[model samples]
Each structure stands twice: as C-alpha cells, then as structure tokens.
Target: MTATAVNTTAVDLEQPLQDVESCLNLLGEALHRRDSAAIELHAASLHLALAQAIEQFTAAARNGTVPASLRTRLMQAGGRVAAQRESLARATAALDRAIDVLMPGEPTGLYGASGKNERKSAFGGSIQA
Candidate 1:
C-alpha cells in the first residue's frame, strides 16, 4: 500500500472542534481529487482524532456545560462522514457485481458416457469431449 504523510503535530487537541473541521476540509479535497492513498491515511487519522476529541469533551462536560456551537459542528462532521461511508459502500458493491459478471468463476459440469466432463467453445465447437 502507498503511504501518505500527514502532519499530526499540526492538529490542536485543545481546539478539537476546529481541528476536526480542518481535517474534514482536507478529506473533502482528497476525495474530490480521487486520491485514494491520501484519503485512506486521512480517514484513519481523522477517526483517531475524533475519538480522542470526543473522550476529552465528554470528560470536560462533567465539569460544565459544553458550548452549543461545538456540539453542532461535531454533529455535522459525523453526518458528513456517515454519508460518505454509505456512498463508498454502494460504489464498492456495484464494482464487485461488475467484476463478477466480467470474470466469472469456474463452470460446473457432469461426466458423460466417456467418463469425462465435456466442455464447449463459444464458436459451437467441442473444446474437450
């Protein structure tokens, strides 16, 4: 697999919301450009960052109320990721079906009176008998 470098040090854990927003923007650009390697790397980094942010915020919320705007932004980011995941799944399923049709698996057959399984060609000729 190809590796894509990301500057994780640039992500501010203190400003989790903004960090997520920045990562989402980068992810959007990567997706738009169809950069699969970058996308995979970003997606993993984003997941880890988001999880850490959620845990930190959850702990902080026990002390005081979390801001409404921050919660809203997190919700929006989650929705976007969910939509992208669904789209990717659909595309993957379509591609799998196309591949199955184009390159089918081995054919099954029965042995004839000659104790051999016969095979035929597309041109109406016996390939094996």
Candidate 2:
C-alpha cells in the first residue's frame, strides 16, 4: 500500500477510537452528576462514536487483523462499556427493589379490595362496568 493509504487508514482508526474514548469520558461525567439531559446527550454521542469505531474495526478485520496498539485500545474501550453496563444493571436492580418495598405485591385499583370483590348475591348488584 502507498504511504497515503496507510496514513488514511491510521486516521480512520485513530479518530473513531478517540471519539469513542471522548464520548465515554463525557458520559462518565454526566453519570457521576446524575444529569439526565447530559446523560442522554452523551449516551447518544457514545452510541454514534462506538458505531463508527465498530464499522472501522470491522472493515479493518475483513482486510486483516487490526494493528495491535489499536486493538488494545478497542479492547479497553469495550471493557469500559461492559463495566458501565454492569453498574447500570446493579442500579436498575436496586431501583426495582425499592419499588417493591414501596408498593408490595397487593393488587391495585378499586375492584381489588379484599371483601368488596366477593359477590353478596348474583341479582343484588351487577358490578360489571
């Protein structure tokens, strides 16, 4: 390959990888602050950057194994993404537990009251609405 092709390939890999890293940094900050708006924005950015990186990496792989240094960076980024996912899963589970504590397994709505649901007589009143 020509020097220009090599340089272009390097640029393609480097920029997307850097964008992914940058987006992750911003996302981490937003998460730390618990800022919903910032989180949403950064999450979208991260998604785009990660997608671009995946495209570039996939193309590179089709041609040949990605160069080692870039592969290491990609692996590290993937690890960070996994760690973030695990943390979110834990948080989601805790939120679910809290909801359960606040509102147990009891039925909701007016019809679900214990004694009220039992029919006194078939003709006395038609509760069907």
lDDT of 1 at 4: 19
* Candidate 2 lDDT by residue in tens digits, 2-79: 666666677779989999999988988888898889988998999999998999999977865566788899999999
lDDT score of residue 41 within candidate 1: 83
- Mind giving the per-residue lDDT tens digits that candidate 1 earns over 1-129? 111111222122247777677777777788778889988987887887788778866865664555556667778988888877787788789989999999986665666567776566688876655
Candidate 1 has its poorest 10 consecutive residues by lDDT at 1-10
Best-performing candidate as measured by lDDT:
2
Model 1 stretches with alpha carbons more than 4 Å out: 1-14, 108-129
TM-score of each: 0.68, 0.75
User: TM-score of predicted model 2?
Assistant: 0.75
Worst 10 residues of 2 by lDDT: 112-121
Q: In candidate 1, list every pair of residues with a backbone clash.
A: none
